[model samples]
Target chain A: MAKSVVEIKNLSKIFQRDSFSVAALESIDLDVKEGEFLCLMGPSGSGKTTLLNIIAGIDRPTGGELHVLGEDIATLSEDALATWRNVHVGFVFQTFNLIPVLTAYENVELPLLLTKLSAAERKEHVLMALKLVGLADRIDHYPRQLSGGQEQRVAIARAIVTDPTLVVADEPTGDLDAYSADEVLDILSRLNRDFKKTILMVTHDPRAAHHATVVRHLEKGQLLPVEN
Target chain B: MWRLVLKNLLRNKRRSFLTGTSVAVSLFLLSSLAMVYTALGKPLENADSIPIMMVRRATGIVFPMPASYGARIREVPGVAACASLSWFGGYWKDPANMFANLAVDPENVFKVQFASTIPPDQLEAFQRERTAAVAGRRLAEKFGWKVGDKITLLGSLWGFNPELTLRGIFSGGPDDQLWFHWEYLNEAIGRMNVVGLYWIRLEKPEMASRVGEAIDAMFRNTPNETKTESLSAFMLNFIAMLGNVRGIILLIGSAVTFAILLIVANTMAMSVRERISEAAIMRSLGFRPAHILRLFVGESLLLTLAGALLGIGGAKLLYDSLRLTQIGQFAFADLRLRPETLALCFGIALSVALLAATWPAYRAARTNIAVALRHTG
Candidate 1:
């Protein structure tokens, strides 16, 4: 069996909003092995993004141990969790949440700024990351100046610039057109197969699931059996 | 991050400029006005040993006291010297050109009040020449008067242009005054010999209050009963006549501070509101809460500090170049920005920026990343 990069046991999440209690996740027991490409599929309000967020350490699991890279992320302090997220995980969002003011190079260099990399090394890594997304020439362009496809590409470059252990993408191509979406999905598949990154993606599109090694179904706050 | 801060400030030009200009203008006014006030008080501050008490009528400083009191105060044991002066309020060439001129005892003028401030040779020249006048260097400089230059005073309160010869120019005394023989004024006023006030120096500093009381007690129930106060007390009384200046200025400063604080704070809060998503994005990018706090607050401080430097430097250049002297007959005083005022300007800038940025920075830093992301998501 492959080494498990993530292990979850009976995880549950309850959200309290103004005298209303809603369960977002219930009794989720799962494992994401090293170098595995897992895709979670569901309709709206199905907690697909919530599950990915829990694995990314940005959202807390309410009632179970969530171990990522063999460490219990639930037990970490808020700041330690931040450091852990910085060093170990990367995220690609539905909206290409690039800081509009920063250039593509600066945006891609954002995560690595927290590291002890020298300026020269940061420049090299930023250049290579943008090169990977085929945006090396557009590094000086601001977000508003970039096309939607190019902006999402820059977002992907920023996500992997620090070479994190796990990359969690939530609808990474949700805002892209067909051509752009194919380009982004192709890059994700390459990162998983060629670079051996453990990718956990949340998407409703079957075309996105085609790149995943295993696709699971999430419905009504419960993990269903594998769809494919 | 500092680069990001600079870019954020530039992203919204109008709000940033308005807040920065508000801080600039308010502090410019505050610092410049306070500097003028401080300059006005400088003479008194430096007059540590004014050396004499002024005796005035109990009614007011504008009222005249009996000239006979000069002789009586001389008889008092502690009174070492005495000189009586009547104000000679007249101008040459233009009534707008105003300076202090006093009809005083030329023989004892240098002895009682202005001793050692004038040279003995100049005092002798002033005494020997009957129409001789000793003018302060500033007044002489204003009118281009030198020794032996006969300057005519027009519209004297006694109704005569007393043609006085400038016997000497005194540099050590007040730069905006003149002293001449009382004999000329007495004769001009039909030998009335009445005076406005007497300047009396004590034999010892400790004898001031006792001698003052003794002098007033001797004149009790008399028609022109007097009030004798030390020089510092007289200066304080004059300042009190200006009517709660310090209190009013403090109130104005506080109001300006509160106003700027609110304006800048509201601006910063609005900026944070608009960037709620960006803040979450920063956190998701591994920024700790402290980072966000420092970024927002530091941006505010940078904007305010930039404005402070510009305003203070502009005020210094303007005032230093003009040395504004046209403040309603206050010809001798000038407006100047000191080093201390510069420090105060930047200090107020930094403090108010911190005050304005505190709430916004705290709220932005403590923002829930999940909720913020949902708002943006």
Candidate 2:
């Protein structure tokens, strides 16, 4: 209905580790509309992670074009790609990798440091993001003081604090218990539905995939349209 | 940002304190040793306190001058007085108390030089009495000498057993020395034909060179050649005998500074490695790689400054309360830390910290967020 926020054409990635070659992706063409909740489902090592990384501009594709948020990331240099990722893509990792040295508020305020925002403004944004994730009270707590689910919430808060266009989550709930996983999924769903943020998630869990408006399956690096 | 750096330092208080202490100790040794070396080598602050002995017109080792030259030297231009001296090497009645003891004309020795520790009345009284000598306070204290005591010295240069009365104990002035009269010394040697050197004092110090030349020309055909130097230059020559101790100390100082640098660098590398995941997380949250690098490097500078302050404080305390006065008349001139040295140490430490940060900061800056997250996860 709206213009696509992420446009990809003939995207492919090859993994070459110590002279062993593996085709991680093959001519993958996809369009993600603005505010869409898209799920990429596949078994482990099926190019789901690679595709997500490429979209996030964290990795460059071996061959093909990827235009995420109107920027052809494949043509950008490493520095430009890093800058682009900072402004356009936010990542949620499976392990909820928060900096152990920093408090939850500092962790969430990290992204704002790159901006020219005043310290007061950065604090306001960080508090709002934490409140959105329902962890405003835990702002001063260290990562070790938080639960697995709470840490993931802080990670998500860090991701959305900058209000980027695309949120790329790579099995964000994989390390949590079922209840915690559901709780994290609920927050992610609310982000998509209420904030109207575009999300591209990689997950093998069917129930986790259920929140996406569109779910695509990848097998052997090839994307297959869902029959349902 | 400064708050963050400070907080991190305070957070790891034990580790920070230990590392800071190591740096402080090394720098303390460096600064204190430098002060000691300077005190030993530099000219005494007061110049008028000691008598000067100058020989004329021969550069190498001082061969024996004819005993007749001593009388002629007494008549040279600007010469207030003169006395012949023989370098008598003294061994204490106990071997461990051995120190420098030279044989001089005892009558003129007191007139030409002042021994601060010796009571004036007693020094005059010792000069009038034969075989009587004033012992330096430090030397006397070392061997436990009393005014009326008798000490035995084994003399190597003149080859004799010299028994002397310790008439009074004397302390140090600008030129710290220990001496006894040549009369008591030469008479005991059973020879009246040899006087090894001449000690001269001038009313006007600047006329010493002309006076030396006039004296040397007076004995042109004599077999014993002479070498003359000002008091300051003679002491400088003595300093040369220690064989580049100053240079060696400086080299050690630089080496210690570099060692501290390496330690700081290693710490930074380990810290950066441990924080790889945090770096990635920050990058993902739209924080630039440069920001992380700054944070890490800033933390290093903070640690180094703390160590430097501790080191400088310790050095100041030690230098101010130096107890080296026990080493005889040699007083350290202005034994306080120079602002320049403190500034130099600070500059060196800061540079070392910055140098140490380069690798870690570059690694953090170049790390790929995607790859970093994957590995960390």
The candidate maximizing lDDT is 1
Docking level of model 2: acceptable
lDDT of 1 by residue, B136-177 (tens): 776787778888888777777778778898888876545567
Q: By summed lDDT, which 10 consecutive residues of candidate 1 chain B come out lowest?
A: B326-335
Tens-digit per-residue lDDT, A31-135, candidate 2: 999999999998887899989988888778999878899888789876677677778888898988887778999988877777889999999999999999999
DockQ of 1: 0.63
Number of backbone clashes in candidate 1: 0
Off by over 4 Å in 1: B39-43, B49-60, B63-82, B88-95, B111-122, B128-132, B146-165, B186-233, B324-335
Residue B346 lDDT in candidate 1: 77
lDDT of 2 by residue, B93-168 (tens): 6666657677777677655554355677887867888787777676777677778887788746667868887776
* lDDT at position B310, candidate 1: 74
Q: Clashing residue pairs, candidate 1? A: none
Model 1 has an lDDT value of: 0.82
